[model samples]
Target: MTSSSRALLFLLACICWVPVTAGAGERPARIVIDPGHGGVKEGAKGPGALREKEVALQIAHRLRSRLEAAGGEVYLTRERDALVSLTERVEMTNDHGADLFISIHANSMPTPRMRARTEGVETYFLSASASGEAALAVADRENSEAPMSRAARGDSTLALILDDLVRTEAHADSSRLAYAIHPRLVARTRAADRGVQQAPFFVLSGVECPAVLVEVGYISHPEEGLKLGRADYQEKLAEAISEGVLAFLKDTRRRDAARPAQVAGSQTP
Candidate 1:
């Protein structure tokens, strides 16, 4: 072939050689939001009878609105004052093939005195062991509804070890999601930054995708409790969470796009 013809042919060949990623035109990510506690299972109680279940549901509703506006397909485990099992929550998330799971709750200390001293937001992902006393305590309180028998707990430990590879990746993604959300939550609410943590939260276990449990604030704290009861504050919390979710999803999409594709080689005829 002439030099000019050969160059043109090579360019066409190169264009044909490019690999196509399977999910290049994937739809917007799906997300599951779990509002902690409901019905008879009211979560922590604050002064003026402000219940965690009620606050969590409100936040979840607001978050769903924001996420939907950002082009995410959002699902909430519970939309009202109704009890939902932890297993059911996990199943819902997996069934939807959600990209992320967020469990929302208001925190509380053991005693009124302790609650007064503690005020802030902390995010957590599943782990066999908690990051610290506070994380363990939070996990314990959250797990109370779905208490695992000693045998079940043992089985869960084994499952964690047996599925190490899957769990490790999920854990890493969960941590990244937590970090992405926690900072914005703290900034928007102007709450103390309790930082991200790891804990054996039953609600977060067995999720197929990155999952996190967020403690928005201490409901037992006199001042923070009042804030948690306010509709305006709840809206702010929802906005921050939505921002974080969009940020994480954007990063995930970028990483997926940068991944190397499997190129199919042509055979000599």
Candidate 2:
């Protein structure tokens, strides 16, 4: 072959031999972290008046840092102690097209006496009815936003329909996500494992992707409340949560890779 032709053919061969990396065109996974309650809504109050909002935001910031370091894009619904509506939080998550949505909060019991008895980490996914009485109570507290309308608070037919659709589309993934993170959170903090449950948390509803709300610990408990206020403990919680998220994402990617590609014009009943 002529020198010029040989050179051209070699270049073409190299081009054809180039391999596409996994996730070549995929954008970094986007995660939306909603720190529960702020501004006038101090949420639950613990010993020494440690507000749930403050603790949630602190943990969220730490979680964001950890997730970012691990190559995920993260956004917080409210960076400051401002009142962000539940609708606004969901809108932010949907607008970002997040791969995962996590709402963070600290748990509190109805009475100081109950607080003393209860201490643990629990995660929740959206559902029409709460898993049990405890879950229902938590949902009621978390869903109590001042700006929410009476209709929003009530069990309207439309709301039920929407909830059903959300559950149908995201329930399995949401459950997996809750299970994935809850164990890590408990192990890292050496806190009690309250276990994962389903509840109708307003902040978690209407999210486009897998969504979960985590009660990292019971701030109402004297011992647990004090531990939650520590920077080292917060760091441990953040690290564990981040690790769990990474593991879930990796597993999802693997599952997707294993699935057969859909042929054009294919239909399923």
Worst 10 residues of 2 by lDDT: 13-22
Give lDDT tens digits, candidate 1, residues 121-182: 88888877779987877888898877674245785674565357344677788988998899
Model 1 ranges off by over 4 Å: 1-24, 147-152, 155-168, 263-269
What is the model-wide C-alpha lDDT for candidate 2? 0.84
**Model 2 segments more than 4 A misplaced:** 1-22, 146-153, 156-159
Error of 2 at 16 (Å): 31
TM-score of 2: 0.87
Clash count for each candidate, listed in order shown: 0, 0
Candidate achieving the largest TM-score: 2
lDDT of 2 by residue, 1-269 (tens): 89999999988654322211126677778889999999999988878978999999999999999787666789999999998989899999999998899999999887768989999999999887789999988988888883463356676753675556564647788988888899999888889989999987777777889999999899999999998888999999898888788778877777778999999889676
Error of 1 at 160 (Å): 3.6
